[model samples]
Target: MLRFFRVIAPAVLLAVTLAAVFWGLAIGGAADERTLLDPGDIVRYGLPLSRTLVNVSIAGLIGSVVMAVWALATDRDEYRIAMDLAAASAAVLTVASAATIIFTYIDVSNLAFSPDASFGAGLAQFVTEIELGQLWLWELLLGASVTVLAFAIRGRRSTLIVLIGALLTTLPLAQQGHAAGASGHSQAVNSLLVHLVGAAVWLGGLVTLVFLAKAVSRDRLALLVSRYSTLALLAFIGVAASGIVSAWLRIGSFEDLFGTGYGQLVVIKALALIVLGAFGAVQRQLLIPRIATGERGGWIFAWLVTAELAVMGIASGIAGALGRTATPVPQESAQDLVGSTPAEFLTGDPLPPELTFSSYFTEWKFDLAWGLVCFFGIAFYLAGVIRLARRGDRWHVGRTIAWLIGMLMLFYTSNGPFNAYEQYLFSVHMLGHMMYMMLIPLILVLGAPITLALRATAKRTDGSWGGREWIMWMVQTPWSKFITHPVIAAVIFVGGLWVFYFTPIFRWAMSEHLGHQWMIIHFLISGYLFSLTMIGIDPIPKRYPHPFRLVILFATMASHAFFGVTVMTGDALLLADWFGAMGRDWGADPLADQKTGGGITWGIGELPTLALALVVAVQWARSDTKEQKRKDRAADRSGEAELKAYNEMLAKQAERDAKVGPRR
Candidate 1:
């Protein structure tokens, strides 16, 4: 069975994927020779084919590393095999990306292959100067790095870096796909990223499992399968949700589902997803447990894996083809937008309607990335709480409510009216920033997610880093200890606010999508760290006394208030080019809006700060009460032995003092 799988599984996947790619290309007219500047059929067809290989290679590399980190023990053959898979996949990715760059150059420059100085110069300029070329070149470089790093790194920590490098290689592609300035550019890019990652992990994991059949013992194999099942389930959800979003963005309307070739390909891919999802469900619910029970599950598992891979190949192939196809809704670039306004030219979207109280509730610009984060954040936290309940372990209901509320707030801040108007309104941006930095983190810290996870998750005897193990590793690390320290957290929490707004980072965050995401992450983490130091219930390496915590809070408040006051009173516009050039006709004057933002920063933070202080005071009183009760119990057990010892010591001291006085 193992030999059959090793031979048949990859062959079936490759054959089906190739067939689907060609079929999709034929339907989408992606391979049609252009009336002008035609780069020949080979360049047209070869580009998508090479990209298909790139996708498959990315899946294999990232998926194998993820499986190794999460499921397979490092000391076993399974881990070694997974890393070998990653190295091999990285090599393929590097080669395929190079081919893609060459083809892209051929298509763009409309030049035939030649080994001349002119050709070389043009090619060099293309790779060095063009955005598309630079993106692919960076991908090739990262892929090569992963290829080398994957071979040497076997430990979980180092392997994780390799995994991150592998994931980074995909970012260029995501950016490349959406850099054309699609209508919902940010959403399209984020959805594609989610799709790529989820699909890669799901498909590549199955491929890795096929190769692992002979690598581990039967009992261990069952355990690995069970672990992989969990990953597959989560990947399925991500892929499905992201697929819907991507399709909706491209197709635009229900009628286009049947009207356009791109839509048809999307439909086919969606069906493939459904089929793959069904396979995953069966594997998780039936095959895995049956195998663990020592039932006749080997053939069943092999056949199921083969079927799923074949379907995944179809989905992967169609994905590449759809990229080349024209969307039903034409991608609106700056040139395409008729009479484009300054706001549209700069932000790539039209100016929203005037800001009003009702509009604040009505306006929305959903961010798929943060939307997923919020969704999964709530889902998994609830799952942990539910798991505790099922095991008859007590969990505080207030924590659950706090966590849910926090997720809702996160969703709203990132995806609702605040996000919608932030680009145009500095006040709105500052409001969201303050919430991200103080309010949301305060509530989220109250959830004590880490503590709940540690209690709810079962400990693994194997060396694999499960949820509990990963949590422990994170909190126990020296770096984690340093960052979570009360003083360090306070500095980061307070100092980061000043550094971010006063530096070029603020401009970058405003203009670039990636920088914007990074800003959100930094604020949330900094805020969480500070909140954790003050009143967090999670176990950490260090905790200050309540009095010291109050001091830190007060100091932070003073710094924060000073920063806000400076912003409010400043005459200069921080991002004058961006905010001043927006040409918005609604709301306050640019300078006045900047002042409003500063006011928001200074004022909105007080509520959360006061809440933190109150929580700290309550905890302090509780600590004192607990200490008093403990002392009372000790005194009762000792029957006033401590008091007698104290009296005896006082008598001796008095006697010594009298003797000394007489001598004097």
Candidate 2:
């Protein structure tokens, strides 16, 4: 039965994918007449086909590497098989991405192929000069890079890096999916990205498992299945949530779910998802447990997975078509608005109402990515805490509260009124920055999530890896040691202010969604590292002496103040093109707003700095007290033997002096 599944799964996947693509194209009007020049039949059909291959290959590449790192033991045959699968899939991804680049260029430019220098030059100009072409070119290069890395590197650490690279290869593709200069653009892009990654992991992991069904030893097979089951569950949730967001963005209304061709395709995909979810539930609840007990469920599991893969293929096909399908509501409605403001042109939203104290809490702009992150973060942290309590282990309630507060603050900074106005108001942006980099980290570092995770998660006695093992490995690695160093963390935290604001990075973050997300992640992580170095309860590679830590804190504060003062006193506006161009009817002048931001940098930023210093001072005093008590305990245990020995030595010395006194 397992052998039959191994043979049939690929065939079924190919057949269903092709059928779904054609069916969707027919319904979505892929062949509809248009005003623009058509690139011929090759591009009309070939582009979506190539895209389907790209999605499948990316899934295989990322999923195999993830499974290798998270499930299989490093020394086992299963690990090597997974790596080989990754390499092969990466190679396919490279080819598919290259094909996608060609198809996309042809589709966008309506260009004909020619075996001549003129054609080559045109292609080069398109890739180098055009935005759409450049995105695909970057994706292609990344795919090729992953292909080589996957083939050459098989060590655990290197595989992890390769997995990250594979994941990154999907970013450019994600950005290119929907028009960026539209309302809800950020949510659409974020949702699509998450959906792609989640689907890839779920689809690719299952495919790899089917391949490994015969290769893995019986004892390890159960463990690998169990591990993959957990990953699939998480992936399922990501896919479901992201799918809903994406569908909502495109479909606009529930009635359209049946009214429009795009919506109908979405309905089909959603149905496929439900089917996949049902299969996944059974595997997680029934098959996994049975397999773990040394039951022979491999054949049954393989067949079920094969069926799921076929369904996934249909969804992938529908997804490929959805990207090309025309929606009922035009994606560029914001751009189409009459007399749009610069803010509307750039950020896809109108200039927000003037900043007010109450507006910060009431005005809300949802950032789907961070919203999901905070939701899941708080949920998981609370679950861990609950698990510990249920096991009769005491966890500090304060830590849990701190974690929840931190997550809430993160959500607010990323999704609240501050986010709504940050693009238009420099001061608001600065407020969000300070909160992200300083206040939020300060609260979160006190939570000690890693410690909670270690205590709450069950230890895997089997050779297979799990979340705890992965987290432990990450913490103990040399890279973690280097990043956690006090000097390094301090530099990243303090130096980032000058580097980010003074360079094009500020403009990039303001203008591009991906760049903005990257800025948040970088600052948050840097802040967490710096906070950990100073007053973190979590274990780290090394701890700075209290006095040195104080000095570091003071130095960092000085640097931070200097940065703020520079911005405050600057004659010119930072990213004057962005903030100056907003053309707001309310708020302070651009320079004045910038100075307000600088004041925030200097004044508001100092609050966290002072709190950290106080915490460090208290810890230093407690350390001294603890040391004194340790000495007293030693004296009590030794009964003053050292003092008695010293007295005897003094007496011996006195006798020697008395004997020698006569000669003197």
Strongest candidate by TM-score:
1
Looking at model 2, report the run of 10 residues with the lowest lDDT sum: 291-300
Candidate 1 Cα misplacement greater than 4 A, ranges = 292-295, 335-338, 652-664
Cα lDDT, model 1, residue 314:
93
Best prediction by lDDT: 1
**Residue 17 C-alpha lDDT in model 1:** 90
Q: Candidate 2 on 1-664: residue-level lDDT in tens?
A: 6667667887788788888888888788874656689887788888888888888889988898889888887777888888888888888878987888877776777778777888788888889998788988887888889889988897876787898899998898789777878887877888888888899899889888878887866556676777888889889899999999888887889898899899999999999999989988898788876664645676667667777878988898898888778887787745677887888887887788888888977899887778889988998999999998898999999999999999999999888987898899899899899999999999999999989988888887656667788788888889889988888899999888878987889888988889899999998999999999999978787777999999999999999999888888888988888899888888799989999999999999999999999999999999999998998888889987888899999999999999999998
lDDT of 1 at 155: 91
lDDT digits (tens) for residues 1-86 of candidate 1: 87678889999998989888999998888988889999998998999999999999999998998998889888888899999999
- Deviation in angstroms for 7 in model 2? 2.1
Clashes of each: 0, 0
Residue-level lDDT for 63 in candidate 2? 90
CA deviation > 4 Å runs, candidate 2: 33-36, 292-296, 333-338, 458-464, 643-664
